[model samples]
Target: MEKTNTVITIGRQFGSAGREIGYKVAKDLGIKLYDKEMLDRAAKESGICQELFETHDEKPTNSFLYSLVMDTYSLGYSSGSYTDMPINHKVFLAQFDAIKKIADEGPCILVGRCADYALEEYDNVLSVFIHADLNARIRRIARIYDLTDAKAKDMINKTDKKRSSYYNYYTNKRWGDAVSYDVSLNSSLLGIDGTAEAIKRLVEIKENNNNKKL
Candidate 1:
């Protein structure tokens, strides 16, 4: 792994081994990996319960109170509008704030919870999306959970839908859209270990002529 200041944010499909890849990337680079740990940090910082963050984790709420959503996802912030908003809005914003705070600290790997969108304004970020074909995902999920193929397929679809909705609802970018990320990988093509290695290469490449002046 190359040593650089880039913060890696991974957006992934269900059963795509995205978290595992993130762990590998973090380990390879000797940086921290933030997944559910990020929720803990957000809960502590915002004085919100960790359970609520867990319950709503990657599931979109029915409400859309834009009035308070922008207060800072405080991707940009003002405190007055943030007060008295719905709990869903608060949870998302808190996580958003947590993402920024984590990135500010240094290079690390952030998995999901719109971390890419949260740190879009920051330099030294490498946003990636990981996905695999439906059959591959179903097989992986089935083997992991000891489920029948049909059951695994159902679970995979539901999880992906939830993740897509949560991401699309919160960020301007569409979930799983290649255009939205700096790199998009098919985990089926390279397998998990190969995918992780690919990501390391991406970091090195991004560190090279990667001047979009980025």
Candidate 2:
């Protein structure tokens, strides 16, 4: 593994083999990889309820008047102190801070939670989207999670809907859309390892181009 000054963010469909791919890429790059661990850490740091974080984490956009909530949270106008901050606002701030902290640490791979959109303006960032065919995804989910085919199909649809809504709500862009990502892969075709290798190659090429300009 070689070190590079770029961070990779992956947005993936459930059962699309994104976590495995992201981990492999991070392993190959010798940089940290963040996923659920981020939520756990944010919960600990913010002193907010973990379940609230989990519930709202990567959740669909809220129509709760964000500006009003943010203003109240900012002014410390809840119960008494910032501790009185609404769970939603606290979770949002926690994740937002965590993202910045991770980026400050060094190059790494981040999965989910609209991470690509979070760091969209950063100079050294690569965003990826991964998806698989519906049947392929259903089968994979069924086998891995031990669910009936119909149940698996339902789960897939629900999960994707939640993820899409969450992403679109936060990013204002279509989920799994190629335009929002630097690379989009059909995991059903290439499989997890192949997708990782492809991304590794793309990262290498991108790094080389960056080096040339530097």
* Regions more than 4 Å wrong, model 1: 63-78, 210-214
- Candidate 1: the clashing residue pairs are 72-75
lDDT of 1 at 169: 83
Error of 1 at 75 (Å): 14
Could you tell me every candidate's TM-score relative to the true structure? Answer: 0.90, 0.87
Best by lDDT: 1
lDDT of each: 0.89, 0.84
**lDDT at residue 192 of model 1 (Cα atoms):** 92
Clashes of each: 1, 0
Candidate 2: residue 3 lDDT (0-100): 78
The regions of model 2 sitting more than 4 angstroms off are 61-86
